[model samples]
Structures are given as structure tokens and as C-alpha cells.
Target: MADPLDLFLAAPPGLEPWLAEELRELGYAPQTTAGGVTVSGTWSDVWRLNLECRGATRVLARIAEFRAFHLAQLDKRARKVAWGDVLRADRPVKIEATCRKSKIYHAGAASERIARAIQEELGAPVSDDAALTLKVRIDDNNVQVSVDTSGEALYKRGHKEWVGKAPLRETMAALLLRAAGFNGKMPVVDPMCGSGTFVLEAAGMAGGWQPGRDRAFAFEHLANFDAGAVSDLRRLDGGTSLHFRGSDRDAGAIRGATANAERADLTQATQFDMAPVSDFAPPEGPPGLVMCNPPYGARIGNRKPLFALYGALGETLKTRFAGWRVGIVTSDGGLAKATGLSLTESAPIAHGSLRVKLYTAQL
Candidate 1:
């Protein structure tokens, strides 16, 4: 039988279809559900998904799934499974448990039970920042246990060392690029490219680069996984040369982005400049994507100036970027409306604890 793999993708409310399509593009025809998608593949395909997928927050491998009515039964089943095949005795692991309408409704108690079982029976260490994590969800007396294969949330990318205040995450940036219909063929302009996350992610995608190429994943510690096979699969090179551009009024932000690009070995693929929004322009193309996460007054502490900034942004897009697509990530709806551009679609997304909306405009 093929090595069964279950993938979990966390999306904004009403973005499961987008995630499913992203998976399909990666050669996994995922079955869509209320909050996530499920797919079956081998270990090779699992590595590919972890490397290539930009829309997913985490990818998990379902190791065991069964029904349990009590904590004793859960512990018995968890211990009965061949833990040696999946977890190394020396490597540390954390257990996160959630109970919903189940007999064992105490999440903490259940997590403790599992942790004790893994440690006492299997000799694995317990930790919170473990490279590997076990996720257990008990719903209606049915238990599903899975191991997180993607370590460090896949957005770390191991490239960005400096981040500005309220910086957009790499995963969110990639999804916004896709939502804006950006194929990475044209020059992408970020007027307020704080830390240059969008620009770098676009450059990587344009070059067909894998996100996990330089990072280590939790699944590598699993006994069933073959290190040589994973290395061989990742040996395929993503060819070179990409066109991406980012600009910010802050000279420091530009410098940070340049340094980050150099660290990611993508300096040749992206260019960073220090320029104000009023001076921003599309680079000789009608098909480029203009994406920005401007100051929203909550973290930046200046609402009045932000309105002017949004207005200036709207004026720029309306005057210079005809036929180009625009995407704005902002938490303030009023400030976004100040842009005065016709919005085509707006979707709610969570960025940390504060919920934000992604607005799309066509010019």
C-alpha cells in the first residue's frame, strides 16, 4: 500500500477551496472539508508538498485514527501502536490535545496522559518546542492522532532575519499573491514593502524554488522516513532568473530586505529601493501585481497620516496602474475605504491575534 499521508491546511474563513486548488496544483487532489483538506500520498509526495505548498500553514501525517470513549482506552491504543516506527526515542516531542463534545473533555488531562505514555513506554522526551509534535483531537468519542511533519510553521523559510513592526507572514504573502492572480512573470511593486516579505516570496515562487530546501522538518526524525530518499527527492533544482521589485520609503526597511534577499540567495531575483508611495510606479507592464501592507494606525499609532497614505495609494493605482491587479492587507476598514478604489473582493484573514481583511482592487 502507498504510504498514507494526511495533509492539514489552515486557511482563513471561507478559503478552503483556495487551499484545495493549491494542493491540486501540487499534484494532490485533496478532498475538501469544512476547515481543511485530506489527501493520501507516499513519503516522497509528502516532502514535495512541504516544499512546494504556499497556502498551507501546517502539513500533518495521520499515524493513527480510532474510536475511544475514555482516557484509559486512549492511552492503551496510543501505546499499542508501534511508536518506534514513527518517533525516535531520543528526540523530544510535544502533545497538543483538543476535546470537542467527547467523553474525555479535558484537553490538559488528555495531553498529560499521552505525554506520559510516550515518555514512560517509548522513552521519548517531553517538550513544548519539540521539532516534532503530536496533535490529538477527540470529537464525538472518535480519536484522531497525527504527527506534525512541517516544523517551524513552514513560513520561517530560514531567510528573513529582520522583521518590521506588524510584518506580514510569508505564508499569508504567498496566498495574497495567488489571490491577486500573480504568476510571477511581471514586476511586483510593494509601495510599503516592510521587510520585503512579499517581494522575496514572489521571487522564490517565480523561480520555482522550494521553501523547505534549506530547512529541516520534523518528519525527518521519524523512523519510517528514509533520509537518503528525502535528500534524493529534494536534489531536483529549480532553475534561475526571476524579476521582482520592492520599494519602501524607509531606508532601513530597504536595507533589511536587501540583506534578507542576500541571505536567501535571491539577491539577483529581487531589487529593493527606498522611495515614497507617491514616487512608486509600475515597471513598463500592464500585467504586474501591486501588493502592499500599509500602516493601519493600530500598531503604527497614526491614523490621520494613514488616511492620507491610503488616499495617495488609491490615487497612484488609479492614475498609473490601469489593467494591473492590486491587493491590500490592512486591519482598518475605514482606512482601506479611504483609498477610494473600487474593491472587487474582500476576505477575512487572521494575522496573529488581530483579524484583518485582504482587499482586492482592479485597475
Candidate 2:
């Protein structure tokens, strides 16, 4: 039997612990790191992680690791590694190199050497446009080579094709949902749903659906891919019945969210309506969670109007939704406080160029 491969699940900054917790729930022992979580598994584990993990931006498998002080040694060692076991001679690959505090100070030169080695040894064509990527990092004279098993960012999910301005990524949405203590059992409500990302993700979790089911992965191009095993892994079993709801003031966003729910085959479990936060109300039955990512005003260049919006949202939640939990995502603390809810803030999270946090409360 081949040794287990080292798998790295890339998490957004400040969400490592939540991602690690999610991985542990999936029955894998994960060590949380600054940027992500690391686990030891085989190629089959690689495919499963890419398929099941919702909070990971991507999954990278460490193909080779060694020490090289200079370019000659790097090229020689790169060529000696067996690339044929994972990469195909017919498929093109893209090489991306990062050099940090290493004798190999020039990243472009290192990438060129590795690219040439793959061409000469594996007979594979390298192209910048290729979807399959090999990430080479030289840090403190330690060289690590990894392959991006996820072709597109897992946030794509191939379900919600429409997005509004400065939309929340689906991966981040999943992690935030986990952070909010959602376990696929409670109902979810998003009053300011942009493209219904939170609603759709909640419905998927309740439906026992795989986020990667409707998509393709870069691992399919690798030599170790098993078609039958992947087919078996994609088979889903029982799921609980839950109603996830969302509403938006924008008519276009409502239409798009409904379409996205249809595409995900989750319309029965979700409902997107055209309504503002002032008109928001909890669905019938026991109280669940009210989660939303409202405007932060950084993009709008004004913070005054958002205060009213947040205050109105807080008032609505407090007045109508009794015994429900609340989670609001935003970059501004003052805005989050404007709601007047007793909320606790999460660690600073990297959202594009802005740093945001998830504010939680129970009312």
C-alpha cells in the first residue's frame, strides 16, 4: 500500500478553527495552522475532501518535499521525483512558485527550472492557461511541491451563478454558518440575502447534498483518479427536512436567488422573497437562526444610511423573532453595534481586501 498523502485544506484567515472543527466532524484528524488545516490521507482522501469540505477554498496534496539550497539542486531533485504517478503526459500544467527567506531568492527562476524538469522528465506540456497547477514553495531552503486538486475555487459550487456587488463567498458562508452553530437541524433565515448564498447552503446541508456534486475537479486530470470510486462517493443517503428562508429588497436579486435554488434542486427546501429588513419576520414553527450579510458601506462610501438599516434590522429581530439566534456579518463595528443587540464579535476575517467579523447574539 502507498503511504498516506499529506492534504492541506486552505481556509480563509481567522476561520481556521471552524474549518478544522468541520473537518473533525467529517471524521478526519486535522491540525489547525495559520492559513489552513493539514491531514494525512491517500489520493482517495484527497478526492473526498474536495467533494465534502465546504469551508475550504481549495485542497492541495503534497507531492514532494525536500531541501535544496540552490537552483541546480532544486532542478535535479525536481526531475528525480516521480511526477508520472499524479500528472499526465497529455494534460498541460501550470507552475506557480513562491520563495521566502531561502537561498533560492528568485521565484521566477525556480518556476522555470521546475517547469523545464516536468517537460523533460514527465514529457508534459506546461502552460500558464492550464487549469491544473503545481504550487512550488521554497522557504528557508526547504522545498515543498503540491498540486491543486480543486480546479476552480470551491466557492463556485456550480449552483449559484449570480452574485451582487461585493458578494460573500460560499466557502466563507459555510464557515460562518458553522461558527453560528448550525448543524443542519435548525431552520435558517437571511433577511438581506443577496444571491441567497446562506439560504442555499443551509438547504444543501439539510438535504445531505454534496457541494461538489455538480462540478468537475482538477484531480480528474491526474493519473490516480478513480472514476468508479468517485461515483460511489457521490452517492448521498438520508437528509432531514428543514425550511431555509431568505428575503431581499431587490427584485432582481429575488429572481436570481429563486433561479439558483431551482438549479441546486433545493427549491422545496428554500424560499426567496422580495422584502426589506423592516418587513422581515420569522417563519412558522420553532425559532431558528436569523443570519445575514448586510452592506458594510465601504463600497458605498457612506456609513450614515447603513446605521438606520442595521438599527431597523435589530429592531425587527428583537420585536418579532423571539427565542431566535442572530448572526450578522460586517466589517464595521459601529454598524454592527447600531443594531443594539448584545452581540459578540469573531476574530478579524479576511474578506477580499477588507477585514470582517461575524457578530452573534440570542434573543
Candidate 3:
């Protein structure tokens, strides 16, 4: 049996607490820290996280750490690492380095040294286009080396091929749903569903579907990979009743969303239609959560007409969606206020270059 590893679940800024909560629900003891949550487990846990955890942007294994004050010392210690035990000789790898408050201030030089060490010691070719990456961070003379087990970002979800402009990432959507207190038992409605990210996520949760069942990870190329063990992790628990729905004014968006649902095999659990917010109506069942990511003029164009759009959305929810809860993601505070829904703001989350917040309210 191999020794346990330090597993770090990377989250977006200001969403670390929610991600930590999600890890706890997954039956792991998680320690929340800046930018991420940390836990300890073996290779099986790594595979399980990549396959099941929805809120994590990346799952990294902190394989090695040491102190190095100079380049020669760094190179010597790097060469001493048992790279063959963790990395493969046939697969190409990339090295990314960052230096902070350390004597080794040159990040490029540090990356080059590590790259040379891997090539000489493990015989693995280094390339910028490699899917596997080794991250080196030097903080106050302490060097922490981790491997990005998740090659592409986890938000890709392996099934969502089509997307609209200013689309929300799957990771962020899951975490926001967590913050909104959504489990799989209740229905979820997205009024402005672009490609139906929230609806698809809700259906997957209710249907007991693994997020990475259709995806591939970089860990498959590592020396510790076990195909049979990983395959066993995909056993589904047989999902609950379906009650997810979505709507959009654009005909093309509805078509794309329906296609995405079909690709995920979640069509039985979800419904998408072409309707503007003013025409939005609640599902016939018990009241659930209403979530949407509306245009905030920063990513999409014009801000003026958005005020009227928000006003109509607020009116529809207030009058039609009685006994329901609401959550909206927008960058502009004024736009959120235009809804007039008595919303409470969450901590600002980093969305690309722009920071956005999730506004919640009970209608």
C-alpha cells in the first residue's frame, strides 16, 4: 500500500468556504484555507475527487516539498526526488514555477532547473504543450511541489460541448447552488438558461450521475494509476425523481441546451423551453429555488435596457413564483438592485477578470 497524499481541492476566490462545505459532505475532513481546501488520502481518493466532486476547479497532489535558497541547491534536491515513482517516462510533462519572498526570485530559472532534473533523472521529455503539469511554488524559502492531476479544468464536465457568450462555469454553478442550499430533492429553475448549466447540474445530482464519468484526467498517465479500481468508482446509486427546468428567449440557446441535456442522458430529468423572463412560469410541483445568471453589461453589451429586463424579472418572480427562493449572479450592484427583490449579497467571487456576487432572496 502506498502512503497517504496531501490532496488540495482548488476553489475560486471567495468560494473556498462553500467548497470546503462540499468536501465535508463528501465524507472527508477538510481544512479550509485561502484559495482552496486541503485533505489527506491515497490515490483512490484522488480518483474519486476528480470523478465526483463538483465544486473543485482542480485537485492537486502535493507530492514533494523542501527548502532551497539557491539555484544549485534547488537543482540538486530536484534531481534527488523519486520522479519515476510519480511521473511516467513515456509521457511529456510541463513545469510551472512561482517565486515569492525567496532568494530564488527567477521563476523561469527555477522552472528550467526542475525541467532539466526531470529529463535527466526520469527520462521524460518536457514540452509546453504537455497535458501533465508539475507546479512549483517557492514561498519564504520553502518549496512546495504539486502535480495537477486534473488536466483540463473540471468545469468542462466532458459533456457540455456547446456554450453561449458569458456562460457560467459548471464548478461555479455547483458551488453557488450549494450556497443557495439546494439538494437533489427539490426542483431547480433557470430563467435565462444559456446551454442549461444549472439545470444539467441539478439533474445530475438528482440522478446520481458522476460529473467526470465521461471525462478524462491527467492522473491516468501517472505511474500510480489503476484502471480497474477507478472504473469501480463509477457505480451509480440510482437517482431520485426528476424536477429540473430551464427557459430562454433565444431559440438557438434552447436548442443548444436541449442537446446538452440529451448528451448527458439527463433529458428525462430536465426540460428546456424558449420563453422570455416575463413569460416565465413556475413548475406545478412544490416551490424550489429559482437561479439565474443575467447579463450585467460588462461581458455582454448595453447596460440601459438591462434595467427594464431586471425589472420585469423581479415582477415575474414576485407575482408568479410565490413561496419560492431566488438567486442571481451579476457583476453590477445596480443591476441587482433593479430587480428590487430584497437580496442579500455573497462575498465577491472571481469570474475571469471581473468579480461577481450571488444575490439571494426569498420571494
TM-score of each: 0.93, 0.98, 0.98
State each model's CA lDDT, in order: 0.81, 0.91, 0.91
Give the C-alpha miss distance for residue 258 in model 3, angstroms. 0.3
User: What is the C-alpha lDDT profile of model 2 across 178-271, one tens digit per residue?
Assistant: 8987888899999999899999888887778888888999999998889999988884443557899999999999998999988888888999
What's the true lDDT of residue 284 in model 2? 91
Better of 1 and 2 by TM-score: 2
* Stronger candidate by TM-score (1 vs 3): 3
lDDT of 1 by residue, 1-363 (tens): 126656666655446666787788777778887666778887777777777787777788877777889989988877777777788999999999999999999999889888888998889998998878999999998888888888778888877998987888887788778877777676677889989999988888788778777777888878777888777767334544546788999999999999998888888878899999989887754568898889887778869878899999999899988988888988899998999998765666667777777789878
For every model in order, what is the number of clashing pairs? 1, 0, 0
Tell me the lDDT of candidate 2. 0.91
Query: Model 2 shows how many backbone clashes?
Result: 0
Instruction: Please identify which of the two predictions, 1 or 2, would achieve the higher lDDT against the true structure.
Output: 2
Q: Cα deviation of 321 in candidate 3 (Å)?
A: 1.0
Give per-residue CA lDDT, model 3, range 1-363, as digits (tens).
246899999898989988988889899999998988999999899999999999999999988898999999999999988998899999999999999999999999999999999999999999999999999999998989999999999998888988998889999899998888787778999999999999998888767788888889999989889999998997543465857999999999999999998888888889999999999999998999999999889998789989999999999999999889899999999999999889999989999999999999988
